[model samples]
Target: MGMMDTLDEWHSIYIKAGIALPGALLSARFRDEGSDEQKMGLLLATALACLLACAAAQNNNPTENLALRGRATQSSTYYNYVFGYLASAINAIDGNMDSNFYHGSCSFTNNDMSPWWRVDLLKSHKISQIVVTNRGDCCGNLIDGAQILVGDSLENNGNNNPSCSEINYLPNGGTQTFECNGMAGRYVNIIIPGKETYLTLCEVQVFGVPVSKKPPCS
Candidate 1:
């Protein structure tokens, strides 16, 4: 079965068992009339539930103990939550290294011939690696060129300003992966300059440990 199917099965098992998700509940409460603060809080809660639902399914011992119940879990499911014509992925990898990472998949269109995909983590992270997978599958155009930006911020703003200090140029697309040598920053930007392909991202893989490269904690 697909990763999404696995997530759905897990959601059914752990979500409706009277476990009160404050974030999800609150989001639903004021979904329409809530302020930006409310919406953000709701989104964080939803992200948490998503992570937990994924964790419960991956773990075979959800009923083991309370410690197991409160722990956070990660998933490789590619949910298209971005505001573009492409889908994005949030994946976790296992290894001995500690770092921060982000991955995005972009789809091409006739209007935007030069497709560029970008996002900022908005917080500090020791990003050490990045990967741009080509899931063309013989349907969309292959991505042949790519670049990564790492710095204090992108475009002098905390929103999307990460300077493109490192680049990985691939003129022909099969599969491409880029690894940086331990750079610390608050934003990560990916730009793809190539043909516009339809539904190009199948999956994106981001690998990092939480100890040194901490995810945004509030």
Candidate 2:
């Protein structure tokens, strides 16, 4: 489905769950004439509203690291001459927290503008928190300014999804937790916006509950 369609689904879910969401306002901004900047602002506001609703739901539900059960991919893979494709995207979700890059337990992307990595949870979920582990060997600062986005759309490689939070700074080899406040989405994305740099993630753990039990991506 298209981005707007995906957003409509989110709006319906929130409305059905009895959460107050400005769905009409959101639709108007998208469907009516508006500047790109204004639309972008509205989009972020709508995403935040979804997140707040999800956060309320999280109060009564238990969550786990859903990323372990999901499929992972990245913008590009980093190939090591000696280790081959040791920096593959799947490493971050392998349930291992090894921070050393040489240990073959981290996902690394080729140095590129707006590098990103994503995980598909197989079904929509009300995400509560996302934990990211940075590489300890070196270059942890490169992850600074990275964004945590959650949504069902694959548009712009999921980078255009609503953002849960931004990493100002994460200490080397440090594992940081980002609260999504219950943003509902089937996909979670990590992207460094507006700069050319490597994206390395030692581990990415997502916690949440399924929004529905239905089969996805059919």
Per-model C-alpha lDDT, please?
A: 0.39, 0.85
* Candidate 1 Cα outliers beyond 4 Å, as residue runs: 1-110, 139-141, 156-174, 193-199, 208-218
TM per candidate: 0.37, 0.70
Clashing pairs in 1: 108-197, 144-170, 153-161, 154-161, 154-162, 155-161
Worst 10 residues of 2 by lDDT: 209-218
What is the C-alpha lDDT profile of model 1 across 1-218, one tens digit per residue? 54334434434544543234553453353425668886666556656766665554433222211111111111112244463322322221111111211233333323344344433343454544555445433432434344455556545222244443333333223445556444665544444445443223332333222224222221
What is the clash count of model 2? 0
lDDT of 2: 0.85
Q: Please report the TM-score between candidate 1 and the true structure.
A: 0.37
lDDT per residue as tens, model 2, 1-218 = 54466667767766644566674555563455578876687678677767766665545434468999999999999989986656889999999998999999999999889999999999999888899999999998989999999999999999999999999999889998888877999999999999999999999999988876332111
Q: Cα lDDT for residue 86, model 2? A: 63
